[model samples]
Target: MAKSKDISVVIPLYNEEESITELCKWISRVMESHGFHYEIVIVDDGSTDNSWEIINNISSENGSVKAVKFKRNYGKSAALNTAFRCSEGDVVITMDADLQDSPDEIPELFKMIKEDGYELVSGWKKKRYDPLSKTIPSKFFNYITRKITGIKLHDFNCGLKAYTSELVKSIEVYGEMHRYIPAIAKWNGFNRIGERVVQHSARKYGQTKFGLERYIYGFLDLLSITFVSKFKKRPMHFFGTMGTLSFIFGFIVATYLIGEKVYINLFLNERARGVVEQPLFFLALTALIIGVQLFLAGFLAEMISINSNKKGDYLIEKKIGL
Candidate 1:
């Protein structure tokens, strides 16, 4: 077991070689000024630049700076997941390496977690430095997120956030689910989430690594988390409901068509077309087949859910006890 620290600043960086040294220095000043016993854990997400080298040098220069390098670009979620597993801080803080997320908020965030009794605290970039291109889409995304998760944080994707070590350890962040950390925490029974109006600065170095596709992925991740959180232990609840409805609808349509044909032939005493000759017959047959397939899918999903372990198993290339 590692010695517990007051705070562990976990940064997930990609090609952020230029700003890291300055970021670390700023963080060190904040931590030292606050009289905090902190460790800076930087996860280098397979940067092709000198980011890894810079990380090694920074760790050597500052003994409190620990490092982890991924073998490839596994993404921000993977980086956070790996660092959370190894953090030794009572309250863990996650921030971006782009210099947009200020280290000055660390003390207040720490206080919210320790003194204010919040399980997780998310930073809200109320006055964002980002342009309308990013901000507009972000607002739309945040609105949808707030409506769905019922956590009214203005910015769900803000990197500047704090969590109790227990909260981070209990939840898993994979894919683009990092944006929904609070939702994930809530799903794991940590509902005491707080939001702080943090200062968001303009990027000092490196262009935004993400593109418009991020919102698309974010929405997909939201749907995934919603389904998984509700039905992970019982996938049959979702798949089975859809399957049953489809099967019942198809059966009703088939029966109605068959009964109409029988009535025309027997009661009306008129010749009726054969069931197979009508297009309705094929449509009903297709629906029945689809319904059966959906039911089988639900059955298979249930079987898999019984044995599934959904936690991430990312490959760590290097670690300082991380």
Candidate 2:
């Protein structure tokens, strides 16, 4: 007899053939107890090892198991993106390929999304088994994300996330932004994001591919998201604001110079130097030039905001399809 599938688990795999089979067995044991139809989608992200072969064998044994292979390593984002397209379950769960993220927590994540009305539910590793090297940078990253994104979750990048199809399709998880899915989902107007403390086992296979540099990238991405959120439509609002402030500060400096000359002429009873001779004149001139450049920048940004529909286009006119 064949089992009907209701829940789809999408795992992005890269050089983890040793762990895939064990992970699948665990998933089968835990998920079948819930008495719901489920399918496992393993996205092979260009693994140089025999991961694709392993996934193919599993898919043949169990109709519920599916595999998607990439030609080369396009990263976790591309893997997830491809897996999302292949999913067919009512609930879609995303977890790491390594055996660290526990399959036992899948039921709870499923319950949260299906019953609790949460559009997205991410797992929180309150007590991670990772070393201090990984954990320290992770803490800083999560801290900044909480402050800027305001989701207040302990772990935003915990690969064990459950999502409905709506939230999945609304947000794009490219360029290391997969680590900030909660932030992206929030920016897209999905605020019903909930988090649960899930079990985090030590990695039994494969080394952590990420490094501390991801924290730096994450902080920069936070700034990018914040800017895009506040000024996506009115980019001039940001640039124009800096331009106006610079111009005003420059004007104030020039005004001070005028006042100094006025005092010398009136009180000291001496002829004052012309505005052109004062050193303040050069300062004001520099300020004015900088201000003009910023203003022009804002103007150009406004025009770009109007036409930045294609993000990959380097030359603005190239996107015009000419």
Candidate 3:
């Protein structure tokens, strides 16, 4: 087993050749000044530039600097998740490699995790240096996330965040779900999340890797994570409820139409329009079909959830006896 350190700074980079060396030096300086036994785990997410080469050179020189290079770009979340598994620090701090996230915030974040007892501490970039195009959407995204997750953090997507070793190890970050790490942590029972106003610097190296499309995907990911976290084991709760309501609604509509036709024809002794002629009949038929499909879908999901192997889905905190 690898030796544990006081702190581990995990950075996920893609094509950040210019800033890797300087960022490592800055982190080293801060760690040394603070008397922290720290390791820097930098994951190169399949960068096409010299980023991986620079990382390799840095790791060769600094024994504390660990590096991982992907053959192809897997994305920031994959990089972070991989590093999280390999990190052996009591406190794990994550920051962007674009130099936008300041290394100066590391000490206070570390203190928040160690002394203040926060399971996860996310950085809030109150005054950002990005253009309105990016900042505006980011603000809106964070606002919606805050409302949904109820975490009260202003910046949920900020890369400069800190987590306890246990918190990092317990939660899984995948897809574009890295933006909702706080929400994930909360769902995992790490509710003591903290936020600190951190220094956000303008990019010192390459251009922004992400575009506006990220916000669109980010919104979809938020809904996804929320649903999966709440109902991963019991998907029937969502699908079954919707299916039941839809089926009942269709049944009621069809019943009303049929009853009206029967009453008009039999009681008034007058010819009535056939229930099949009304557009409502088709609507009801469509709804009924959809409802049955949804219900069967839910049933299948339940069966899969029951039969699926969940060997490593849970982490045991303690054991009393065999």
Encode model 3's per-residue lDDT on 203-309: one tens digit a residue. 88779989999999999999999998998889899899889888988999999999999999999999999999999999998889888988998899999999986
lDDT of 1 by residue, 22-73 (tens): 9999999999998999999989888999998888888878999998888899
Model 2 lowest lDDT segment of ten: 313-322
Candidate 3: which pairs clash? none
lDDT (C-alpha) at residue 142 in model 1? 98
- Write the number of the candidate with greater lDDT, choosing between 1 and 3: 1
TM-score of each: 0.95, 0.85, 0.92
- How many clashing residue pairs, candidate 1? 0
Candidate 2: give its CA RMSD in angstroms.
5.7
- lDDT, candidate 2, equals 0.82
TM-score, candidate 1, is 0.95
TM-score of 2: 0.85
lDDT of each prediction vs. the true structure?
Answer: 0.91, 0.82, 0.88
> Residue 193 of model 3: what lDDT?
95
Q: Flag the better candidate by TM-score, 1 or 2.
A: 1
In model 3, what lDDT does residue 321 have? 11
